[model samples]
Target: MRPEALALLAAACWAVAALFSAPASQRLGAIAFSRWRMLFASLILWGIALASGGWRSLDASAFGLLALSGVIGIFIGDTALFACMNRLGPRRSGVLFATHALFSAVFAWFFLGERLWGWALVGSGLLVAGVMLAIVWGRRGDEQHGWEQTRGRLAVGVALGLLAALCQSVATLMLKPLMASGIDAVAGSALRMSMALLAHGLLLSTGWRGARPLAPMRLRDAGLIFGSAAVAMALGMTLILQAMKHGQAGLVAVLSSVTPILILPVLWLVYRRRPAAGAWLGAALAVTGTAFILLR
Candidate 1:
């Protein structure tokens, strides 16, 4: 498959995982859900790495970089994303999270010295406008589905989602050079997850009340969490890194953040209601912005 297709496939994986995330994150709480998800992902990736001898390519320097990348990307970013989901639900949260593509472009411009002066600037404005539009008007006044209910302050969830996007972009930027140099995607991903799992372990050991799950995990919750962990962390993220080996960071991110567009149909199916007009318009703007960056 082409690198761009790999990025889109990663987006599909994330969209499916987002469907599971609302339930599991609500049941397990964001921190605990993330802990379990990273644990599962770490183990699965390690199994693949060892079996395929991908671990052989992991030097100490590679380990250090990938490990830090994992902690920032998966540990902080995934936790914040789920916390955002807990408050904003998946659909709106997804629109917010899609800003990572824009964030990645900006970060690349500053850090990697990638140029961003043409259509990219216009797209950035559109992306920001779309995010605000979705958050402000994505739901009807009468729409009271569990997924659309605001859990806490709207401000807090929006902050977390954008923070998740920023962290994701930074982490991806950090890994571009390594991935482009032919690192084994599986082993590198395993190392990253392992480091993130370690971070979660320490966070749990702190007995921070906020870090604990509100309820015990049910069998069904376990299934949901495992499936999401396997699909999103083990497969989707690895595919993004693989795409990075050949694709430009901005293009890859723009494609991978198509999660907002991909998740809407499933959301409609589950709710038995079409999305609000604002949701459709916001998604169209965000996707068009992505295409501007992609095709430029």
Candidate 2:
């Protein structure tokens, strides 16, 4: 498949992952769920890498880079993302994460030296403005009467989300160089996941006190969460790497920004939830902006 196609696929996987993740977090706290998700996903990726001849050909340099990527992107970025989810909920968090696309653009320009087109700049402005309006308007009617309950973690989430985007873009920019230097995609992915697994393990241990979770896990919820992990870790990472390996990371990032748009129809189909008028408008603006960035 083409890199553009793979990027779109990655976006689709993210959309689906978001859908399942919210409920899963509600069942098991976000931190615990994210930890397990990364752990399980790493196992799946390792198995695939071993099967793909990536196990025997690992290089220390590539390993180091991948490990760094995972630490910055998965460990710090993901931890912040979940914290945002817990505090701000999915809608606001998702909007904040649009900043990731902007970050990716900037990082690609710097690291990969990918130049942005005029249309891309225009689209980015629209996306940022639209997302901001959507988030602000969405929060307007919330139960919180003042900014106190609404601001802190939500602000952090937006900041972290932007940082996460930058980390991911840099990771993508680095991937092609590593691959050209003989780093197998599967092996590279495995290395990234392994670092995430290690970090997650330490966090889980630190967070787990003598007491168990406030609520018990259900078997079905466990299955769903694990399944989401597998998809995100194995499938999502694979597609993203595939895209980065062959496509300009900036273009890939812009294309993958379609995740929000992809989620809209899913919400209607899966849960019979229709977005408000402002939401639909925002979503349209986001989609139009993404198209501009991608097509131009």
Best by lDDT: 1
Note the residue pairs that clash in candidate 2.
none
Per-residue accuracy of model 1 over 242-296 as CA lDDT, tens digit each: 9988877876787787777667777778877777788788778877776676566
**After TM-score superposition, what is the CA distance of residue 5 in candidate 1 from its true location, in Å?**
1.7
Off by over 4 Å in 2: 118-160, 180-182, 206-214, 289-296
TM-score of candidate 1 on Cα atoms, chains taken together? 0.90
lDDT score, candidate 1, position 119: 86
List the candidates' TM-scores in order.
Answer: 0.90, 0.82
Residues 258-290, candidate 2: write the lDDT tens digits. Answer: 666666566556545555566667766867776
Output the worst ten-in-a-row residue range by lDDT, candidate 2: 139-148
Whole-model lDDT, model 2: 0.69
